[model samples]
Target: MSIGISMLFTFIVAFIGAKIGQKLHFPAPFMIGSMLAVMLFSVLTDTAYFPKEAKIIAQIVAGIFIGQKLTRSDVIHLKYVIKPTLLLLVILTLNTFIMGLAFSYFFHWNVLTGLLATTPGGLMDTTLIAADFDSEIHIVAIMQLVRSVGVLLLFPTWINLFTAEKAQEEPAEENVESTRKKQPLNKKHFLIVLFVGASGGLIGYFLGFPAGTLSLSLMFSALFKLRTNISAFPIQIRQFAQILAGSMVGSSFTREVAASLKTFFIPALLLIVVYLLISYLYAWINKRKDWLDFTSALFASCPAGATDIALISADYGVNMNSVAMIQIARLIHAVGIMPLLYQFVSFFL
Candidate 1:
């Protein structure tokens, strides 16, 4: 098939899958659904095609989505959770190295690929970075996807199991609604966000930094938001970006990737174990130190998507602000620093 025809087919499949996922209320539904749908089509037809330029565009969109989360108030709130944030980063960094090394040694994968797969970064961010490293991008995407979905599904249930008594006593806190009003969209501001993301992505692409496009775009978007207090991108835009990213990732599937899927079982299990252990450790420490309550600490330390964790924390009636600040710090570090660190380690290996 021609490139245009292939892309169109892939995108249609992705859109259908995204809608199905949304209807089912799946976590990170658009990307995951689209990826699965495209993977099935690609594996069956072997005609899936996602251009490099389109992938770059997707990265820019994902970066901007994350960047819009940052605001001046979030910066001021950073100090409140500085210690927990630092602790979470430290634990996660250590876990990344230890688990990454284990995966490489046991599975005979490249160290960089192992590191990329093991890092508890956002699924899209990690997968994009995997491309820059020439690592097993498919494996990284699968592992990160498993991590994200696992956390979203399991963490809340585990928290509820442990905190059932407390929840019963504090039933009033359940269903507390958000007071923040949604901002009306402006065309000029939307264009500005895209312009900033594209500009930063271009600069990063030219600078030879690891995953520079996405990282720099995120940094630039966040800075723009902080400076101008204008971060307005339509939900549709975000969904479109996710669909594009999912399609690109899905188009990478082939016979080789499919055959290698079974090897992920042990690694995925290990990833979950490490996440649970570290999250529990953080919660234990916090319980003693009283830096944050047990629920907030667990949620913040869980290493899922930052925004999702923060929103979930609110439903639990934990310190939502602290959880959000800490999770954002984790997200920023994972997006900006983890890829660079993995690259540095790769050089020595």
Candidate 2:
């Protein structure tokens, strides 16, 4: 519960995450196993072990990593992802808001609390933004738990079912010839991504961009000038980013919050439906173009992290790996997605 212990917990979880990700051959952006373990620990235990004091520090820890990697050049790099990614994020935000509102109105909870309950991001991200609406932290935590459970479990199940239904398409065929068409990574691009992400954080901090996700992403994109520079960040940086992310995510536990979590069933079940429908709808819509992998488009479009589809793909034999790949693509896209979209939005409708 103390700061040191909390950070230790984060590091441990991150280490576990890294190990599991490597062992499982999960080709995605996160440590899915560690996430499930934490959520499960919170669920099974009757005690609240997360400390409030450690919470903000955990967030700051992650913020530093996210902050440091993002730079100025990324301020406006990839022109394409900016619009689509922003649109997707907006759509997800709106959907979550609607779902949260419905949870309040239909389930009869406080509107502020319900709204915070459903916001789609990390649990702490929910709380940080939830404070703006004066929402109850416990309720927000409870809702996030429910949402995380839904995403963690059902995503894999869906992938299993989808892949099973199309067994004929198993062992995806790759286009070796087209592989030559891809772009290569370079140092100029790496620096640009780092620069954009950092600059965006600086800009957002000054302009009230609500934590540095946008700023970090903008700066990262601006810094990475390569049209397809995927290797700008080193493994260490990526690991640090996940540690920062997990520490903040894990530090949100407490006795009161744990007690509040007892009533997480209804919300959790409801969110599974929400997750399934959203994933399917997004996949269906994005699948319209007939890309090499249909699963990739669907997984990329969903709001869940990279591991969900990857695990599902491996577990259920669906193109979940493809989904995971798409997830990476989205991250690459995120570098330039929002800033450019914001610019365009600034210029026109």
Best TM-score among the predictions, by candidate number:
1
Candidate 1 residues lying further than 4 Å off, grouped into runs, are 100-184, 276-349
* Candidate 2 segments exceeding 4 Å error: 24-30, 37-98, 121-137, 149-206, 214-224, 227-232, 253-258, 289-293, 304-349
Give one digit per residue, the lDDT tens place, for model 1 in 134-160: 588877888886677556656766687
lDDT of 1 at 41: 91
Write model 2 residue lDDT over 1-349, tens digit each, in one string: 6656645655576567656765785433243454444544444542223443332332222233333333334233334334444545666656656876688788777766665576555454455555654457767767775565456545555654655544544434223212422545456755755555555545544654333433344334433433344434433444444434433343344345556555777776787677678767666655564442445444556555332332333322333323333444443333224223323433432
Report the lDDT of model 2 for residue 45.
Answer: 44
Native-to-model Cα distance after best TM-score fit, residue 230 in candidate 2, in Å: 11
| Cα error of candidate 2 at position 319, Å | 15
